[model samples]
Target chain A: MERILFGDNQFFAVNHISDEKSRAQAIKFKDDSAIIKVLDDAMAAGINTFMCTTHDRIANICDVIRDNPKKYKDFKIYPCMPYAHKYANAVTELGIVGTLKQYVPGNFFGSLFKGGVAYINKDFISIMELLVDAEMKMFKGINTPVIFLQNVITDLLLGLGMNELLIAFAKHVESKYNAEAGFITMNLPKLLSVLEEGGIKNPIICASINKVNFRMSGGKELYEEVLKQGRCRVIAMQVLGGGAIPPKEALEYVANLPNVESILFGASSKQNIQNTVETIKYHDNQRVLVE
Target chain B: MLKVALIGAGKMGISHLSILGAHPDVEIVGVCDTSKIVSDVLEKYSGFSCYTDYLKMVDTTKPDAVFVAVPTKFHYKMVKDLLDRNIHVFSEKPFCLNPTESNELFLLAKKKGLVNQVGYHNKFVGTFQEVKKLVKEGFIGEPQHFLGEAYGPVVIKKKSETWRSDPNEGGGCLMDYASHVIDLINDILSPINSCKGAMLKSIYSKQVDDAVYALVGIESGTTGVISVNWSDETYRKMSTSVTIIGSKGKIVSDANELKVYFKSDEHPKGYSKGWNVKYVTDLTEEVNFYLRGEEYSSQIDYFVKAVQGEVPNTVNTFESAWKTDLSISIIKNNSK
Candidate 1:
């Protein structure tokens, strides 16, 4: 695992700051080549891991990567699954029955009946497993070291007290995919405790971490306490606080933290990619010297 | 025509066989291998005679030269027998398992006035060749420090029943993989003078080391470090690179391209002071070999030209590889 991982938020226009900027990004990166160009720029700048969503266009990206095995051999993708927008759109356009028929694997008619029965019985775990398998079908042959449950589902599960589903997701990801399950949550401190209760020890948790308490739900102090005391592995995302903190200060703060294993970020331009990577490395070296 | 015989049907031996068999001015007289299947296949396709015993093949074919691509453990004995018959020889690198044997073979070749070369084919890579050219041209003036790295997924798991995993036969990453980088560095810069520290770690194989790290000083007062790992699965292919720092500028190179960064404007024409990247495709000769890049064929062509007495053996000579073996000796001794 690299200390720096490039995120795919910019490609899908998931800008946290403003919807206007998000729409602009969505328009800017409407093409698959645009996404690949930025990823190549990140690779040239020495970042190897792409912590990304399972967006439909990303399947095209995976096609490019699979075709040129020599160029992207070392490049790994940490797929954040269940791109919520995709599912929502599919359900709206096709209806519930049609969506289930289209997405579910195995005998289509059999799956429809099974899905109907499961929905009637409120068997959300079976539905969740089927959806996970559906989401994972895109990255069939690629190297995905960490399979992340998107924060939407993670925080939803956390709010519902459905901790056992997290355990099942982790176990399925391990047994079938042979990858460690990662959870992205707004409430890291609570999620850590719940995940521990569910038997996922030393879970890899990706959360918003910044200097000014940007998205640090349950506050920043509690997050820090859990990071210091808990057994969870931390990957700090939104270190810039949705463009609130200065890049240098935000990176310096996160790079000097105690238990953050990696920093995940998104940038559109080559210069920005190079600058951010250099800044992180520079600050990391400074921290090493000071300590 | 120069008559050549090949001994061994392993990976490198196949590379040499294809190049030699395809040469216009060369005739592959025989190919000798321990496996009858391998020998029969070569003979069927190449129309070259095949034999199980190398000595018998040499006696019958009476080849003008021999390409010894066997394992390192057999290089000394096989090459010594061929050289005793006053035949030109091209053997693979780490000339032998022992430096003493390498020195003896080198001297014997010189005494016999026979053309002798080692298979440090990296020297023929277009980017590496350009790096050497820039160094000799004083582009990176007065080398200060150099870093050589070679990493790949050659032995990530415990591999047994192969000579490569045996320390006495293959010498693990230090000998099998790092030798190429050491040979390249020695070719580009000054010879190593002393080793400060060295570590050989066995990650998967119990009998041999899979990783090597060393800090050394060259005779020109330049510090150098080399790190090699044969267990890195992150690489889709083997990654070997060299970065050299100097007072005026620096040259960073790999198999694909060369990046030159100059501090001041004293570089050759078409190159500026700041930075320039040149890919091997732009500098490499047209590829003629079947399995590999132009460098593989280029090395064989150089050897064929050397054997024909048209050009002196300047690259990958026994003497040069003997020097690399001396550095390997120092590294292995220091690590222990």
Candidate 2:
């Protein structure tokens, strides 16, 4: 996780508060060119890591990056898994078998006939591997140093007591993609313990760590306690509480946290992006000076 | 009696509230919604405790079952939390927004020995059930091909959006409308084996598709096509139809009627099968308070029965919905 990592929520029109804002964003970033312009602005502001969902549009972004490798050489994507809506839409149109065939790489028929059967036979680990591979397909030859399990899957698995799969994910991402496995969850304290119990040490976890406990499941105090005592690298997201918390207070609150090594935020405009990055940098520098 | 609580105040949630509030076997414990106005109205009408937070509702009411009528994106987390608390869940469909989460929930429900149902109400629709029975009886004699179509007047213009129009939340017409058709296909025909030639178009919203078309092949060697348009205002009301063709006969079913056409008089005893039409009302049992449709109440009744251990949790179980989720996943990924 990199400090001041750029997020794709703005590109994808994910507004937590207002549908009007989301619709506006959808219209503004309807084209990949518009999305690229914002990414370019973020890069120009010296932010390199791009944390994004594995949305279909991201494939276009990856293509542009891959085509002009020199220009975006330092750019990186933290690929998030199970972009739930994408898979949901795919399943509706393709059927599960058809969806798996389309997503699982290599021979479509072979994977459909063989791997699909295995996945149904409860070889879920293999299915997980196939999905990871499918999600990472668009980021081929790009710098995706951290592949994430989206909160939709992460918190579900957390709630299901299926933390072992998280360990398997960590191992698979490390061994296969040679990237760190980042788990984004609403409940960071519980996830950290589960990951630790599953034998993953110092796991990279992205969570909502805000002053108002906006989306933080266990609340701010518990998260701060875990951050102080836990052996995980925390990437604080939703730090602005989806705009519930002011940027200055939110940045200062998270920047002073013990194990928060990164801050992830999304903004459509160049000025908002610059302000956030600068705010985080200023707070981080101030914390260093105080220490 | 099963103590049931509802977790959403959307259209589907209100429907559930109506049924649960009136059903004899159910004791409405609590209902949670983000909208205070919706909660207040439901609370006033139903005399049930209302909360804006689901966790609070669950902890306080301690219902044995929860009806999750929340948005598609919230399905995974909300259902998982209830399932973790060992509470049975009746979730609105698109079981989850994706297969991975659906699979996880399916397995978790099984592991917890809790009854789980997805809101594929068409499975309980009388004509559709009759269609399933006819297919099972081989009235169509070797099912070969099928078609499912849904056209509606909604999403016809540039309107204010909601989660339903967001691809990250609601998967446009593909997830919201076509999903029901796909689930109906799974119920009436063999599970869809593969899908191709998908066209997802956004006429109203840039993020969510308003029209979707796909070709699907079933496990029983039946080829199928699904076409849905939420923006089609040509119809006075929402219209859905399913047509199944086989070697001996063909069945055409719409919202109102089920028509069977057989090559000869070799059909079930009720029909000479040259062509026969049966209104859906004739096939459906008369219900006392059927708002929305009989399928809505019927599905809820089925779920309550399943939860009461009186029947097998057969209709739209997580295992079955996972297949539907996978099919949707295929269509969406292919359309890309």
Candidate 3:
């Protein structure tokens, strides 16, 4: 994982601070070239990894990256599964059976027969694997080092006490794609314990970690306690607490934390991206000197 | 731990079950759903008492509170039954189908002195909470006009019929999507007392309206417009936003952030005369068990606290939901 990974929330109009800004972004990035331009900006700031959801628009972005193989030789994408809306739109257009046929890949009847078997035998793991294959279609032939389960499904599974599914996802991703399976959740502490119980050691987890505990379930103390124990490798996100915390203070807090191998952030402008990278580096340097 | 039971195991019901399962102060006494498959799986995996019959679940569990997440047609009868049993209840939004039924339930809950809530979770969003506070404090002095909108790709093309495709059972965009906006406008500004005109357009659905455009009048002597569309493919999910303009300045907010501009030097603390922006993460309060968003868990937490009498029933109460239901009815009538 890169120390600093560029995110895709801004391109998808997922601003956490301002609806006006989100609308503005929806207009600004209406074209795929605009998204590529921002990627270029992040690269210019010496950032190469793009951590993003599997939105349909990302397929087009992937096409651009695949076309310019020379320019993006070191560029990588960490694709998160079940971009939710894609499947939702599919389910709306086609019924449940139609949805499976649409995304299951391979011969339509063959996949249907497999899904039927999975459903009859109550073998959800097989269905989950097939879905991962479906979501991976867009990222074919790309440098995807890690595939993630979005928090929507991750936390739901956590609440349902479905640790087996998480473990299955980890094993399948590693075996099939030769990539580490990452989990994103709001409740980091609980997820960590569950993953550990299932024998998935030092899982790569991304969660909201900041000075104020914004979106951090189980609170800041529990997060600090887990990080102290070094139970897992964490990718700290929402470090600015959705723009609530000041940049310097937020990054300093995360940068000094233990086992936080990476910081994920999203910014539309090059100046904002550069300033963030600089602040993170400054705080990291200060931590090293203090040590 | 408070004794709690869940009735209905649909998508929303499962989410509620998940959050409640992890709640420290909640004990899952029973779960009721008509589907044997749902109840059996939940019973096996979660180790909770599950029943295919609602009446049997209630009689056996005798829960202190019950979360009613069944379809719309079942809400009034089931919620009324739970309230009659003196059990606190939380029903999913679009409170009840008609104003009369919702009004009766609201009054009954109020008269019986039983705790009641509806699941309009947007109220728990931090930016919207900030928007509520600013509006209450007259951040935009002397409210003049406002606009509420929600758009997504729900019914972009024709598909098989479900509860959502029926106006009576689904309530279409006017209930499923617009009710959130109506509830927000009523909660943030003032109760929507009247609606002048409404247009229920069926861009895709055969029986129900896909888009709702309405002119509404509120109790604060202000009128506003509501525009909601479920067929808009530009958005990935349902996105709601509100803009309010007043004599002093203006305010615009969404689930993500709140933006305000004041004309004079009378700015709120940490805000300036010019445009000021606040993010949801800045204002969100932490919860014990989080699923999708902080708001989802926050809403349930508030309900649990309310059940314990630790907090008053002020937000998302049965009364507030009734007002929204009445607004939906008014829109339907005016559109006709």
Per-prediction DockQ comes to 0.01, 0.01, 0.45
- Report the candidate with higher TM-score, 2 versus 3: 3
Candidate 3 stretches greater than 4 Å from native: A67-71, A88-121, B35-41, B263-268, B272-274
Error of 3 at B101 (Å): 1.0
Fraction of true inter-chain Cα contacts (below 8 Å) kept per model? 0.00, 0.00, 0.56
Docking class of 1: incorrect
Q: Estimate each model's TM-score.
A: 0.56, 0.54, 0.91
Rank order (by DockQ, best first): 3, 1, 2
Q: Tens digits of per-residue lDDT for model 3 on B1-336?
A: 999999987778888989998888999899998765456556655677888878788889999999998768789999998998999999998889987899999999999998899999999998888888887887778899999999988898876777778777755889889999999999999888888999999997898889999999998889999999999987767789999998888998889877899998887899999798777776777888888778889889999999999999888999999989887888788988
The number of the candidate with the highest lDDT is: 3
Error of 3 at A269 (Å): 3.6
Best TM-score among the predictions, by candidate number: 3
Q: For residues A1-291, could you state the per-residue lDDT of candidate 2 as single tens digits? A: 567899988777676544346558878998999999999999999899999998888999999999998999888999998787665444434444455666766764464365534334344566668788878899999998889999866765553345667788989999999999999977677778888888888999988778876555546677788889858888888888666667899888988888788889888999998998888889888888988
Q: How accurate is candidate 3 locally (lDDT)?
A: 0.86
Ranking by TM-score: 3, 1, 2
lDDT at A9 for candidate 3?
A: 93
Clashing pairs in 1: none
Off by over 4 Å in 2: A1-291
Error of 2 at B324 (Å): 0.6
